[model samples]
Target: MTKVIAIVNQKGGVAKTTTAINVGAGLAKHNKRVLLIDLDGQGNLSRGLGCKTKARNQFTIRDALLNIQKGILTNPTKGILTARYEKISVMPANKQLDAFEHSLKGDLDAPFYLRRYVNTLRQYFDVILIDCSPSLGLMTLNALVAADSVMIPVDPEFFGVEGVEQIVAAMTDVQRKMNPSLSLEGIVIVRRNDISIAKRTNAKNLRLRYGSKVFQTELPTSVKASEASARGMSLLEYMSWNHLARAYASLVEEVLANGRN
Candidate 1:
């Protein structure tokens, strides 16, 4: 079965895109056919994977969504950019997506469009990862409705905990009203700085609050991540020996283990 995971946090700078990119890369490294869907208008996830978001010839996630909304007949694989060597593919996005939410306003079936779109892709991929925008808006709702599970990335900060609370509340709403099968994959501590007492405290609080729902692996702060993004490479590919890369590898294992359970 193809498993779709939405890496989401309603707050920015929490490494949601980072988690999506690396986790997708990690899964691909494990021989899984992965498709990354960039739902964020910022298009950072698309760019991070070396996709040309501005390419006029490329079919973006926005286009796909529009097709779904308008009931347009189009090839499902039309816009997917595949990295054959990495076993990964991308449905890119750009600033063109910024107005998508407003366009879907008051559309009763908006939430189901993404689910419908993703269904067409289920047979082609072993995994699909959606990189949500930094808000619990219509797009994220679509993602929540479409995904089998969600993974939240948090920096070790007070507001990070608050972000989790907000998204979890949204998840609860989604479960009750939208997708009853939606489950939380886990909470990940990103940009962790163990030397910082406050960060450690926040990490402890998160683990205590979420218990085993928190992943055992925590991604450490690293400039290499930014560099890798700049170079359009996964951390595992950019610097496999880096500690953060190793942590992400462990995270992939945990994700697979959770799926088996």
Candidate 2:
């Protein structure tokens, strides 16, 4: 069974897309067939994988939603694009996704549109990673509905923790009403600065509060991540031996191991 994981944070700049790209790439490096679904209107995941939207008429998740709205189970195989790495594919997003909320407004089955679409492709990949927009709106709700687990990236700052809390509350509501199987896979601490005493203390306090739900791997603040994104490559490809790359590799291992049980 494919494990659908959403890399979500309602607050932007928390390394959400960075984690999705690298983690999906890391899993692919480990021979896991991974599909990265870009649900965010920003299209960062698609661009990070070296794809330019203007080059072609790429079928996106928006098309899938439209198909579902019409009660047609479209096999979104055309939407799946090959990534720069082996065993990794991507479902790119476009600016038109921003109009999805208004388009599906008042539709009773709106929340499950993504869930139904993802189900059609579940057998084709070992894992599906959703890069969601930074909001608790319709798009985020669809991602949540489609996912079995969620991995939240926190920036090792005060507001990041608050964002995690908000997402947790939203997840609780989602579980109660929409997808009961949805579970928080773990909290990933992104852009941590151990040299800063305040940041270190906050990271510790978060781990203490969240306990086992917090992932052991912490992504340090590194120029490598940004450089990788700018170069349209994963950190593993850009800086193979970097600490952040290794941390994401470890995260993939942890995710795979947890999914087995």
Number of clashing residue pairs in every model?
0, 0
Please give, for residues 11-65, the per-residue lDDT of candidate 2 as tens digits: 8888899999988988888788889999988898888887665446667878878
Model 1 agreement with the true structure over 1-261: per-residue lDDT tens digits = 899999988888889988998999999998999999999999998889888889766689989999988999798887999643355799999988879878888999999988999999999999999999989999999999999999999888645466689899999999999899999999998877656788888888899899999999988988899999988878988899999999999999999999899
The lDDT, on a scale of 0 to 1, for candidate 1 is 0.89
TM-score of 2: 0.94
Error of 1 at 118 (Å): 0.5
Q: Give the range where candidate 2 is weakest over 10 consecutive residues by summed lDDT.
A: 155-164
Model 2's number of clashes is: 0
lDDT of each: 0.89, 0.84
RMSD, every candidate, angstroms: 1.4, 1.6
Off by over 4 Å in 1: 158-160
